[model samples]
Target chain A: MNVILSLIVSSVAVFGLVVIAFVGVWGAHLEWLFGVVIPYLAVITFFVGMIYRVVQWGKCAMPFRIPSTCGQQKTLPWLKRTYVDKLDNPVGTVAVVGRMILEVLCFRSLFRNTRLEFGNGQEIKYKSAKWLWFGSIVFHYTFLIVLLRHLRFFTEPMPFFVPIIEKVDGFFQLYVPTLYQSGLLLGAAATFLLLRRVIDGKMRYISLPADYFPLFLILGLATTGVLMRYVLKADVVSIKELTMGLVSFRPVVPEGISVLFYIHIFLVSVFFAYFPFSKLTHMAGVFLSPTRNVSNNSRIVRHINPWNYPVKVHTYAAYEDEFREKMIDAGLPVEKGAPEPAKPE
Target chain B: MYDGGKIIAGIIIGLALLTFPIWYTSGRAAPKPEVKLPVKEKECVQPGPYMKKKHMQVLDLWRDSVVRVQQRSYVAFNGKEYDMSLQNTCMSADCHAKKSEFCDRCHNYTGVVPYCWDCHIPPKEKPEEKH
Candidate 1:
């Protein structure tokens, strides 16, 4: 099955990464390559590839005002339309912006997700599927927090908000080093998402290796990060030194830093490199999606085809000039009496 | 590209946010924290590498042992038995007299606001004269 194949391939890929990092760092002493070079390369690839993809998507011309809407269209002034309808259909720029904000921030459309099922009496039914939305929002926000929390390592004198985020994240005080909930939640959410793809028959059928790869990769990334923080326990001081060095363009591989840290960052680097090429680019693509971003107001304003060429028209006067003689012979009225009886000339 | 202005603006904003650390720390010094290692004690409650990573966990274990279980003495890896008090053991005159010099160095550098000082009274330390 495709599901089994994807699971195997992605699992092996993550496994291969661990082996590579272990062998590279512990065996070959290529800490600089793993710590410094790869991170820089990954960031460069991420930015450049993302911009390229966005530019490619941007080049696509949407000649029609096709917005996927489920609400009423704006018509006669007397026809009543609710505020919800305006948001759902988005007849203006402001409404479209509001819709997009909700869609991006809260995943409004996914919250309205439904699963279709056939009943015993040949009836079709749609049921709310909020778990996917819940899992997705949790995964995204936690991942963002975890990412932002990492800023402590990259900045010196520490950004003012980093400590605030840290306090909130570690408020429970579960463990000695302060177990961050975001890291744990991110891993759990990724697992749930992966399991949903594997367990659901429809999802499994539609799921490709590309889809499974990211989930597995993310699981591996999160696992390594958690391991470094809790189990393996990488040196925090040394990590900050290395990360601060990296951002400031002066990299140094500090002593006593574990290979687990290398594995973690290597996984991160791979993720960064893979992001633009993978479905993960939906982060950027969401903004460019015509259906979500465009307002559904074609009736109000014309949208001319950008590629349309200028057309020359055969005017009535020109037609009459060419066929005036024929028209007079045919006893049809002429515009100028056959050109002032041209014989006078 | 279509909507070039909006798309480009979005990208610029994203890049600026992503690369904040780069521009924010440009021309600034980010020297790694240098803690003054205790010269008298050759070994800590545990090994150096272990302490570097999980010192908080070790301290927590010691605290729970002393307060909850009433186990006051700790057996180091080197088979040396010692009292389990933070003040008597860790901050003893020979081990680490100045918390600001030894403890605060790495803690502040890593942005770790450990609650160790909240309950345990830190020793009086003179502010390091600025260069």
Candidate 2:
């Protein structure tokens, strides 16, 4: 089955990365390759590949001004329209902007996800399904917070808001080192997403290696990070020294940092390199999606297709003139007596 | 490009945020913090590497056992027994005196605001060193 295939491939890939990084750094002592060379290469690939993908998207010819409308259109003075309708069936540019903001920030469209249920007597039912949206929102926000928390290691002065965010994130004060909920939530939400793909038959049928790969990769990254922070503690100062050295372009491999830290960064580097080429590009592609970005006002405003070209045609008058002689010889009606016998030419 | 202006602006903003640390530091060296280790007492309750990584956890365990279970003696892995008081054992005059010099160095460097000082009285600051 596709599910088993994708699961095996992605699991092996992530596990293989852990082995390579652990062996390379811990056993072989090739710290420079794993720490410096690969991270820089991955970051460069991320930025350049992201820009290239955006440019390629921009160059695409969108001939149709089509916006997927899901609510009542703004028409007929007597007809009543609610505020939600304006956003769902946006007409003007401002309304389109509002719709896009909702779509991008809140994932409003995905919040409207529906599942179909088949009955025994050839009947069907549609039910609201919000679990995917919930899992997705939690995963994305927690991932963002975790990334922001990591800025402390990368920066020298440790930007002003980093500690504030860290304090709030560890507000519960659950464990010895002040457990951060974001890391736990990230792992939980990613697990939910992966399970949904595997358990739901219809979802599993449609899911590809691309979908499972990122989920598996993220789960691996989160597990290693959590292990490093809690179960087997790594020297935070030495890790920071290495990270700060990396960002400042002055590389240093600090002594006594655990190999788990290397595995975490290795997965991170792999994620950076894999982002642009995979479905993860939706982070940028969402802004360029024509269906969500365009205003649905095809009747009110003309949409001249950019790909439309002027087509040449032969007029009926010219065609008739060219065949006038044959038509007269066959005793058919002629326009001007066979064009005056071609002026004796 | 179709929407060249907006797309370029978005990319520029993204890059600025992504490369914030790189540009903010501007290749300037941030020297590592240097702590003044106590020369009189060299041996700690545990070894150096263990203390470097899990000192906070060890402290937490000590706090829990001292308060909840009324256990005051901590037996280190190396069969060394020490009193389980932060003030008498860890911060005495012979070991890690002057919290500002010993504790604050790495804490300030890593920006970790441990609340150990919130309850316990801080050790006295050391006098200025002679030139």
For model 1, residues A1-345, the per-residue Cα lDDT tens digits are 577887898788889998999999999999999999999999999999999999998899888977889888899889888988898899888999999999999999899999898888989999988999999999999999999998888888888999999999999988878889999899999999999998999889999888888888889889888888888788888888888888888888888788999988999999999989999999899888788899987888889998888899999899999998999899998777666545654
Question: B4-78 in candidate 1: lDDT tens per residue?
Answer: 999899999989998998898884647887888889889998888888888888899999999999999899989
- All models: lDDT? 0.88, 0.88
Query: Fraction of true contacts kept, per model?
Result: 0.79, 0.74
Candidate 1 DockQ, CA atoms:
0.75
List all candidate RMSDs to the true structure. 2.2, 3.4
Interface RMSD of each: 1.3, 1.1
Residue pairs that clash (backbone atoms under 3 angstroms), model 1: none
Worst 10 residues of 1 chain B by lDDT: B122-131
Model 2 sits at an interface RMSD, in angstroms, of 1.1
